[model samples]
Target: MLAKAFYPTEYKKQKENSWIRVCVRFLLLITLGVPSNTLGSFQITDDISKLSVLKQNIPRDYNISVSYVPKELAGMCWVKLNIYYLEESLNELAKKFGNVSSNKNDIKILIDMLQDMRLPLGHLDPIMYDFECHFRNEQWQTEQYFDYVKDLLKAAEDNISDDCDPPPCPTTLPTGKGFDVI
Candidate 1:
């Protein structure tokens, strides 16, 4: 046949390369359509800044109710809950995927974000007092409280639809596709 008579190995290699190039182009086309404006960064909820909720939820008595906590404080309560949840999730991920997995990167990023969010020593009293009475019930370890930060970061990452900035606009298009880039 024509294939056997010609440079067959070179032809086969060319075909393989074409397939890879096509696949890459197709993936770029699909992902590129997602606009930059639609993307958002991973960050804490803005509910903490609402003065009205803070006024209402700031405890005036020794007894506190976690259910009535403001959104910002509720963010903390969720962080507390997530510490245990993430520990368990990581255990499960380890069991399924062995020690190394994609989730490990996510875990590391979460840990870094949590450390950044840590409350300063000076402002810890009222927050800790309310957290202990309303959220912890009895008493929670300081280490455990800090550990919850990983969960907060993970949650924020999950909440963000587009964690990274949109890819740069495509500057060139293949001549055969007859595509124009503006």
Candidate 2:
């Protein structure tokens, strides 16, 4: 038909170019987004600055620097996180996720992984927590958020591989969908 006749070669080239662009975009997001903000950078809970809770879950290594940027929290949210991690390079530890999966269950796997690392509370009954860590509405946009998660996973992965103290049980770890705990 028309596809096979006039534009066959041009059409094919166009398709190939489109595919290349998509891949480049994905890589760009994954590379730039993944390391600095997507996966490995450390993320203190959005509300970690809330006195008691911040004290409760202080990281063993890096300190969380809270910028009281109420005005620019929105204007500078993503940019700030990006710049912060860019300087620290904490994003180097994170694994960037591509487009979200259609499957809810797959999403659950990431949530489960977070719990196993003790970043989140044990998963059980209700999603609410006596104490829980949560992302701000804008957090998902930053590379730092995922990086924090990556750091915890890196620890748990090392722990499980080393047979050290038999990584905490799921219920004990308290992480999953619709659940939170301190």
Candidate 3:
């Protein structure tokens, strides 16, 4: 016990060819203990339309907006204001915006109701919104949307146009690529 404690083995006399093994062990230790690369977190952004769909919060995208319609005298007008609200689906979208049609369940009338819908700038019309939705969501169901839009256009041309009314440009509808148009 006394010899073991007093005459500890010296390092110079014990090992001969372990330098490579030592370096490999040190490198492996560093590779395992220390982080050599950083990892990135995944993220998904919430859009205004998705907010309406999710119904998680108040929709302020169209809050600070107003509409103006010139009266027959060209000097004054009484605008019928519309307050935008989120609906569950297309049926509800039509039911809530009933002023656009005599038939409440009419999808064509619902498309027309978009005219009353406004953006945060209050510069939107139904036709514009229709085009905006289509333009914005490239994956949107165009055939269904266009069927209603065409019907609304026909109704406007046949029953509403009085020569003094603004012409409907169904063909030149805006295709929004981003938030610029909506």
Using lDDT as the measure, the top candidate is 1
Across residues 1-182, which tens digit of lDDT does each residue of candidate 3 receive? 35654333455434534776788899998777542112211111122223223222223232211121212311110111111321113444344444745333344334334343322214435433433322222222323333333333333223322132333324554445322223
lDDT, model 3, position 126 = 49
State the lDDT of candidate 1 residue by residue for 1-182, as single tens digits: 35556588989999999999999999998877553223543444332233233223333332211112222434534443333334433343234433464434444444344343432112433433444323222222323322333335555445522122222333453243222221
Q: Using Cα atoms with residue i matched to residue i, what is each candidate's TM-score against the true structure?
A: 0.25, 0.21, 0.16
Q: On residues 23-132, what C-alpha lDDT tens digit does candidate 2 reach at each position?
A: 99999987764422234343333322222332233333533332211212222122222222222322222223234522223334445334433332233222212112
- State in Å the error of residue 7, model 1: 67
lDDT (C-alpha, whole model) for all candidates = 0.38, 0.34, 0.31
Tell me the lDDT of candidate 2: 0.34
Which ranges in model 2 have alpha carbons more than 4 Å from their true place? 1-104, 116-140, 160-182
Point out where model 3 deviates above 4 Å: 5-10, 13-22, 30-33, 36-182
Model 1 scores what on Cα lDDT? Answer: 0.38
